[model samples]
Target: MALVAAAVTYLLVPLVRVFALRIGAAPEIRERDVHTVRTPRLGGLAMYAGMLAGLFVASRLEHIGAKLADPRVGDGQTVIALALAGGVIVLTGFLDDWWGMDALIKLGGQIAAAGLLVAFNVTLLWIPLPNGGTVSLDSTLRTIITILVVVVSINAVNFVDGLDGLAAGIVCIAALATFAWTIALTENLEQGRLSVTAAITAILIGMCLGFLPHNFHPAKIFMGDTGAMLIGLLLATSVVTVTGTVNYDIAHREINRFPVVLPILLPLAVMVLPLADLIMAVVRRTSYGKSPFAPDRGHLHHRLLQIGHSHRRTVLIMYAWTFLFAATVVGLSVGGVPLIVFPLVVLFALVVLMMMGLPLWRSGRGGRGSGGSHSARRGPAPGSGPTTEDPSVPGAAASPHAPATTG
Candidate 1:
C-alpha cells in the first residue's frame, strides 16, 4: 500500500505542477517571502490522489481487506468517513489555494471533516490514564474532543509549513513513529499482522515520502493548504482510531509497559514539534492583542533564521529535534533502549549539533553572513516551486505578483 501511494504521488506531482502553471493559479509573494517566483501550488491534490490509490488497493488485498471488512476499521463507515472528510478538506484547500479563504471558513471545513468522522463512530472511545485507569468519555465529550483534535492538528500542520519539505518531513516522521508503535502494539497483542492505525499510517507515510522529492529545499512544488490540512486530518484519524477498538484492558495487562500512559502519549510525543509550535503561536499572537490566526514571522523556523541559520540548515535542525524527541519516547516505551542511556545520548547529540551551528550563530550575530542563503536570488525552475496557499491570516490572498515565501 505504501509503495503504491508513493509511486502514484511521485508520478502525479509534475502533471499537477503543469496544470497549476497553465491555470495561472499561484500565490502572490509577500513580506518574509523567500522564493524568487510564485510557483504553482495544489500539489496536494496529487498527494490526495496517491493516498486514495493506496486505499483502493488495500481494500482489495485479502489481508488488509479482512481488517477493513471488520466494522471498526471497515464496515464501510470509518474508511468512507476518512475519504469524504479528506475530500472536504481537499476542496477547501483547493479553494484557498486558488483564491484564498477566510480563516474561519477554513476552520469550519476542518471541524466538518472531523465531525464527519465522529458521526460515523470514528472517534475516541476513551482515553487512557497513567495509573492504568481509563477515562471513558461520553458521546458528547467524545465529539467535542475529536473536533478539537482535528482543528488543532490541522492548524499545527499549516503553521509548520513555512519551510519547503519542513511540514512534509515532520509529518512523515510522525507517521513513521506512529506506525512503529501501532505495529508493535498490535503484534504484542497478537492482533494479526496490521491494525487500522498502522495501515492508514503506512499510506500517509508513503504520501509524504512521495511528496518530499518535489517538496524538499529548492522545492519544485508546495503542498499548500490542501496538503497540510489533509495530512493533519489523516494523522488525527490515525491517532483517534487507536483508541476505538483496542482492548486497552487486555493490552494493559498484556505488555510490560513503561509509563502505562505511553499508548496515549507516544503519538502526541511524536507530534510534539507541531503541537508545541501551535501553542506558542497562539500565545505569541494573542499576546500582541491580535487574533490567534494572525500571520507573523515569529515561528520557530523564523527564529532559527533570525539566529543566522540557513534555510536548509534550519529545516534540518527541526527534523533532528523531531526525530530525537520521537525516537526517545518510542525507545523508552518499547524498551528497545536503556532509559538511562537515552537522555545521555540525546544530550550528546544536541551538544554536537549546537557546536556545529556555532559558526552560523556568530555570522548571523555580526550580520555578515546568513547561511549564505540564496533562495531570495534564485528563481524556481520552470513549472516548479509552487506558491504557498497560506491560511495563517484571516483572509490571506495568493497574490501572483508577490515574491514566493519559504513555503
Candidate 2:
C-alpha cells in the first residue's frame, strides 16, 4: 500500500507543480524563509491525490479491505470521514497558500473540519484506565476532546514546517512508528484488526516520502500550508482512530507490563518533537507580547542553523531526534526495557552528540580561516542561505535577491 501510494504521489507531483504555477500559488521569499527562490506551493494537492489512490487500492485488497466492507466495524466510515476532513483542510491550506487568510479565520476553518470528524463518529469514545479498567466519555465531552486533538495536531505540524522536508520527515517517522505499534497490537490482540488507522498511516508515510524529494534542502517547491495542514489532519486522524478505538483491555492482557497509560502516552510520544516546538513557540511569543501565531526564526530548526549546522545537517539532526524519541517510546510500549534497547539508546545519544559537536570539532582543527567564523557572524536573516564556515561544505549560502517571480 505504501509503495503504491508513493508511486502515485511521485507521479502526481509534476502535475501539481504545474497546476500551482497556473494558479499563482508560489510563495514570495520572506525574511524567515530559508529558500531563496519563490517556489510553487499547493504540493498538498498531489499528496491528496496520492492519499486517494492509496485508499482506493486498499479498498480492493482482500485482507485490508475486509474492514471497509464489514458493516460492524466503523473503520470504513472512519476512512471516508478522514478523507472528507482532509479535503476540507487541503482546501483551507490551498486558499491560505494562494492568497493568504487571517490566522483566526484559518483557526475557525480547522475547527470546522475537526467538527466534521466528530460528526462522522471519529471522536474518542473511551479511555483506558491504569487499574485494568476503562472510562467512557459522554457525547459532549467527546466532541470537545476530539476537536481539541484535531486542532492541536494540525497546529503542531504547521508550526514545525519551518524548513525544507522538516514537517514531512518528522511526520513520516511518526507515522512509521505508529504503523509498527498498530500492527503489533493487531497481531497480539484477538479483537485487533487492520483498520483505517493502519491504512491511513501507511498512506501518510507514502505521501511524505513521495513529496520529500522535491521538499528536501535546496527545494524545487514547497508544501506550503496546504501540505502541512493536510499532513496534520491525516496524522491526527490516525492517532485518534488508534488511540480512541483500540482494545486497551486486550492490550493490557497481552502485554502485562505495558504501561496502562499507553493510550495517551503513545500519541504524545509519537508527536513529542512537534508538540515541544509548538508549546515553546507559544510560550516564547506570548512572553514577548506577540501573537502566538506570529512567525519567527526562533524555531528549533532555525536554532540549529544558528549553531552552524548546514541546512542538510540541521534537517538530519532533527530527523535523528524524532527517530530516537519515537523509537524509544514505541520500544518501551512493545517490550518493557529489553537489554538491546539500552545499547540502542546509548548509540543514538552518542550519534546526536557527535552531530552537535561536529561543527566545533572541524572549526577547531581548521581554525578561523575555515569560514566558520564568517558564517557564525552572518547571523539569521530571512531568505538567507545556510552558513557553512567550510567552503567545501554544501549548505545554504546568502545569495543576492533576485526579482520576485510569480507563478
Candidate 3:
C-alpha cells in the first residue's frame, strides 16, 4: 500500500505543478519564505490522490478487507470520515494557496471539518488511566477535545512549513513512528488488528516521501498550506483512532508502570517538536502584545539559521531532535524504562551539541591562518553563507536586491 501510494504521488506531482501554474496557484515570495523564486503549490492534490489510491488498495486486500467489512467496529466509517475531513482541509488550503484567506476564516473551516469528524464518531471518547483502567469522556467533552486536537495539529504543521521540505519531513518522521507503534500495539493488545491508524500512517509516510523530492531545499515546488493542513488532519485522526479507541486492558496486562501511559504519551512524543514550536510561538506573540496569528522569523528553524548553521544543517538538526524524541518514547514504551535508554539519550544529546557547535568550531580554526582554509578561500559553499535579510520581515536588509535565504 505504501509503495503504491508513493508511486502514485510521484507520478502525479509534475501534472499537479502544471495545473497549479495554469490556475495561478503559485505563491509570491514572502517575507517568511525561504525560497527566492515563485513556485507552484497545489501539490497537496497529488498527496490526496495518493492517499485515496492507498485506501482503495487496502479495501481490496483480504485481511484488510475483513477489518473494513466489520461495521460493528466502525473502522470503515472512520476511514470515510478521515477522507471527508481531509477533503475539506485540502479545499480550504487550495483556496488559501491561490488567494490568501483571512486567518479567522481558515479557523472556521478547520472547526467545521473537525466537527464533521466528530459527527462520524471519530473522536477521543476515552483516555487510558495510569492505574489499571480507563476514564470515559462525556460526549460534550469528547467533542471539545477532538476539535482542539484537530485544530491545533492543523496549525502546528502549518506553522512549521516555513522552510522547504521541513513540514513534510517532520510529519513523515512522525507518521513512521506512529505506524511502528501502532503495529506493535496490534501485536500485543487483545482485539487489535491491522487498523485504520496504521493504514493511514503508512499512506501518509508514502505521500511525504514521494513529495520530498520536489519540495526539498532548492525545491522545484512547494506543498504550501494545502499539503501541510491535509497531513495534519490525517495525523490527528490517526491519534484519535489509536489513543481513544484501543482497549487498554491488554496494555495493563502486558506492561506495568509508565508503559501504561504510552497510549496518551505516544502522540505527544511523536509531535513534540512542532507542538513545542506552536506553544512557544503563541506565548511569544502574546507577550509582545501581538496577535497570535501574526507571522515572524522567531521559529526554531529560523533561529537555527540565524545562529550560523547552514540551511541543510538546520533542517538536519531538527530531524535529529525529532528522531531522538520519537525514538526515546517508543523505546521506553517497548522496553519499559530500561536503564540503557538514559545512555542512548545522553549520546544523542552530545551529538546534537556537537552539531550545533560545528560551524563555530570551524570558523575559529580557520581564523588561526592568515589565508583561511581551502574551502573558505574558495568562498562559502551554496547555502553556507550568512543571509543579510531576515526572510520573515519584508525589506529588513539594506539592499532591495539581496538574495533570499534558502533552507
Q: How much lDDT does candidate 1 score?
A: 0.71
For residue 55, model 2's alpha carbon misses the true position, in angstroms, by 1.1
The alpha-carbon RMSD values of the candidates against the true structure, listed in the order shown, are 5.0, 6.2, 5.8
- Please list all clashing residue pairs in model 1, or write none if there are none: 28-398, 28-399, 29-402, 29-403, 34-405, 39-386, 39-387, 40-386, 220-385
- The lDDT per prediction is 0.71, 0.69, 0.69
Tens digits of lDDT, candidate 1, 323-376: 877776776767744335544655665575557557756655512244333322
* Lowest-sum lDDT 10-residue window in model 2: 398-407
Identify the superior model by TM-score, candidate 1 or candidate 2.
Answer: 1
The C-alpha stretches of model 2 lying farther than 4 A from their native spots are 29-35, 69-76, 190-194, 243-245, 257-260, 337-407
Winning candidate number (TM-score): 1
lDDT of 2 at 264: 59
TM-score of each: 0.84, 0.83, 0.83
Report, for all candidates in order, the number of backbone clashes: 9, 4, 1
